[model samples]
Target: MLTNVPGYPRIGSGRELKKANEAYWAGTASLEKLQLTARQLRRQNWEAMQQAGIDLIPSNDFSYYDQVLDMCLMTGTIPARFKPLLERLASPQSLELYFAMARGYQKNGLDITAMEMTKWFDTNYHYLVPEFDTTQQYRLLSHKCVEEFREAKSLGIHTKPVIIGPLTFLLLGKIKDHSLHLHSLLEQLLPVYLQLLTALQEAGATWIQIDEPYLAMDLNPAIHQLYINTYNRIHQAIPGLQLLIATYFDALGDNLATALQLPVQALHIDLVRAPQQLTTVLQQLPAGMQLSLGVVDGRNIWKNDYQLSLALINEAVQAIGQDRVWISSACSLLHTPYDLDLEQDEQVLTREIKHWMAFAKQKLHEIADLAQIATGNNTSLAANMAAMQAKQHSPLIHKPAVKARVAALDESHATRKSPFHVRQESQEVAFQLPLFPTTTIGSFPQTAEIRQLRAQLKKGTISSEEYHQRIKAAIAETVKWQESLHLDVLVHGEFERNDMVEYFGEQLEGFVFTQNGWVQSYGSRCVKPPIIYGDVQRTHPMTVAWSSYAQSLTKKPMKGMLTGPVTILQWSFVRNDQPRADTTFQIALAIRDEVSDLEKAGIRVIQVDEPAVREGLPLRRANWDAYLQWAVQAFRIAVCSVLDDTQIHTHMCYAEFNDIIDSIAAMDADVITIETSRSQMELLEAFARFKYPNEIGPGVYDIHSPRVPTVEEMSSLLQKASTLLPARNIWVNPDCGLKTRNWPETEQSLRNMVAAAVQSRSAVLVN
Candidate 1:
């Protein structure tokens, strides 16, 4: 009888939050105005959920930036580096701390940088990494949970507040000082969690969902014991509050049996992913414990089969009685798009294929409907059943041509025209460059003027001709800057793109753009993921004009930037009715056309960035090879369309490549760049172990931080990299693109990068 929706979308239905935040950051909008906009959006969300008949609506799920960062601020887990800035500003509220943690702060004397952010559990969503040192302490900042609960109550809506579990928080955090193990910090961190839970309890929150998704991972014995100990203490301390320990994305596996015995009120299992675990789970369910069955897929856009879902709910009911069963989503809907109702294009097949569809709003309705049917509130589920049946039988779900092409895909599509050795010989004769050539990872800083111009173009305030001219001018200036620095392999600055993926999606058929379908990719960063609604094909060239124009401006080999096929599929709200391999192959075919066109346009270096390639991997390692097979084939299909002498390059961002080193080599890119500065070239060991033969550019400096790298620092990093990699196989670059950095840091960092490459070349000669 406990119907609930997982986390709600935070980007705002109309993307009002993204616009307001950007405007405030750019000084175009006032702080008061941004605050008012977020408050209004929150109210609208609460009202909408209330009208939808959601039994246990969630609060504190709405984040101005990131919920994990919000948790850090709420528990007073501020790093010492940020404390002085908070003191200098003379504003020490939770909101101030949260924003400072997200955007960072620099006044006259005090300089504080934000914590390092990385992807959240293989999803595009990012969480701020909490910092811990020897003197780490805990205190409740502003009672955020209590405040949000009170705010919702005043609006006549009682809500269950959500908070990140202490175990998961520590699992995601970093120990900078290295004085304490993770378990040591938990003792100090747990008191604050206890305090916050007590406050929420006092504030009349009957239930709280403690998100410990780390339980789903392969945990060590010590960590497993720690989870047991931590929950025992919390359940004993906070006896009044009903605790729902939610584990998602995959089954809890060995942890499931132990987790079921924990002293919690309810156990939320992801039936959509691990439906087989249901029978085993039901057998082990304690007499009084409730079951929150996550029948709706939270991470994807697939519509639930109402008939199938009802049968599963009935099974749970028969196994554990109707009173003990509830319906929910497999994970948080924060990963999903905002509302499907806003997408107005009838040509977008996904919109019309509503049976294979459910956004956050629709999922809530599904939960409520499932709950009603279980409670005997409705007799006939025929209408919803028929709707689902029609969707499964739709022509849109299957395309014979697409299916045939994928089936006929051979090893030749996954292989280059020639082997790496042959390609390398040809590329060396063609490029004729230095031993340690330097280049950037495509984009430069996306300035406010450029953003405004894009916004204006989108709003029809600027003509396409005028916009094209402006972008060309920007690219010219950027090329000039790179030439002045005397760097090799110049990029066109990616001035024409709003995002790497969105740019290609605009030119590709079977993809639909959304004006307001924004989803948070990281702290204060939102991406409007294009929806792949049908069989994809490239209508025309996507990046040829900009690459051609930049090449015309400079004699240096300009790199043609394209988002790889796997990344395009990963980042977009892809069609779920078909296997992802089919979608990726379709995208690969489209990008293949662009690659051939760019090569013909005289762009010798093309960097196809597959940053999200690792994100698409299945959580379980057993299922990795099948995913990697198609993923590598997609990359090969895209890049093999180019000539051997064209010097095909691929870039990966913030991924551990140890397991996939062979697959990466299998892709056969002429050159590969990976993010390595953060891990201190530890990631490059994979290349060394695999004896990876292709050229590599292990990033010489971390681009995420604002701190300018000295030439010595970058030189040292390059030296360390040379020890792990063959000097002949090395190139020099930053960890990722420079879009997130300011002009000052971007220029300084690239200068140091070039200097380091020079230093590296000299050192190799002397050795």
Candidate 2:
């Protein structure tokens, strides 16, 4: 029996990667030390799996940043812009290319910026996007897969190496020059992959897992043929290396027929996501080809019912025989928390409930155990089955009030007090601002002192009164600064909040915080998500105090910031017992109360940020409408309680809003701000094509980097935006919140922003 998982968590259990990476970036740690720590982590991860009896362990899953970026570095497909910096660093071809692509270099005649990065597949994780041009060349920069496989072998473990397939890699990349199609780059990139596969075979790797998740997306007919030809070519070139082409996040769409025809050893499908794909997949299987059934959930923290998963696995075994069937997770465990074992000191009920659950480690064990059962290893199977049986019958799984409420849901709960056009007119009359008004996405810089004070308060080193006073002072200072800059709208700076989601989670019911729970969102960015336990409700207003106080200090409109219901649920550890839609609605009702409270407190403008809403869209288009229906309803329920005269705004970051343009318009926020500076405001083309009616603040500058945009640059971006969007419907702002930047850079960026807006207004009138 083969026992393996697609991928495991790379961010260490206690966020060791986050701390180590940040220290290295801040120049507090040496490269050699960081490398050693990463080595140790790899060893520790491997040993943990080996000890738990997992075979076919995956290597090269560890990445300093993202796996896709690492694949680009390994394949020698570095964009030409980073070449000068790579030459100057005198660094190894791999390390120099990788770091340069992740963080740009501006020294030694190298003034190139990093490629654009965005969220990866509905998770908080981000990946560096590969930039392709007509003249782009491909070669092998480093043997990362072979080296990692050898590293594991040196530690007395044989491993299967993994790589993102060429199709998905190209699909994820952008063609900067626009003349070149991604499909054309495939032939150039294929030889490098073949070379890597041959090296892995020489290094004693018998099985390789190539991820081609884009195959599950709606593909062009030409691309579908390309998948067949690409795999057939590779299989013919290297017949000895067994390849397992894996697809997840959705079922194989029109590509299923082509996927089955590919010359590969086995097929892995995500049963947890698309359970209906099982029968069709079994019927389509060719003789002698193995089936790696992905039955356990990988993206969520839910306790799996082994009995249910066992039934599915048993059916696969019945169809394909025990030897031909294996077990694994539906997708990578990189999206989940590390070990639930570390969360022992949490609430007793939650902790006890967690024992029924499985993290990466436990999931691996489950896969092994299920494989053993399939092979008639019955000694431990009975106990495991009984444990799962007990949990399914537990009282915690069902609550009458929650069930009744969800069943009786009405359409009225999902609608606003007034229609959008009426609300727009009323809001315009009440606020009365000029065309192309200036504002900021909520949050100013969260300084070291603020972070320290928050930590001190958590540790009981400071009183609540002291913390509140310090936060209030910070808010006042921020308002004064915005007034001095002559900005049109102001924000409270979100000084008291640790994160956009965690802050609201702290104030709501059915949620619990983790002391050491950390998951990597990007390179050095980590978030500790709150776990939702039971019925969700709001006991009190979350942001009213800080927002009302900030309004008291500012003559300008102070936008009250709240994380929207969909984002709060998406980013948190949600309950497994109830349907997610029910939990989302409960959260929506709770946020509705807060919105009403904010309006009652004289807060005229409120911003409900739904950054994760796009990420929560279902992977398959067939299932999209149902998910979007509930998600949009949840947002409307939360914000619709406020009066029409109250200007309700929503902010979304790092999303491709083209497909969801109708939904974005349906959201019906009076004003919406989105992250567009990274793409040169190209995302606004969607709004232009749709002729979107609402006000938009297409960001004038990118906030993810430390580079303070020049006034001329910001002015140029605003002028481009004005061409697509009506000047009256446009607003000027940064791409995102300033929590990651230092105060000095934040101040300089805002100054440039205000100056650019003033310049744009004058230029528009003259034209």
Candidate maximizing TM-score: 2
lDDT of 2 by residue, 435-488 (tens): 678888988888889999998997889999999998998888889989998888
TM-score of each: 0.91, 0.96
Backbone clash tally (model 1): 2
Candidate 1: segments with Cα more than 4 A from true spot: 27-34, 83-97, 104-107, 110-113, 176-179, 345-356, 377-383, 417-422, 447-470, 677-692, 700-716, 740-752, 755-767
Q: State each model's CA lDDT, in order.
A: 0.82, 0.83
RMSD per candidate (Å) reads: 3.1, 2.1
lDDT of 1 by residue, 519-601 (tens): 88875577888878778887788889889999999888999999999999989988766788889998898888899899999
Off by over 4 Å in 2: 91-96, 106-111, 347-349, 378-409, 417-422
Ten consecutive residues with minimal summed lDDT in candidate 1? Answer: 347-356
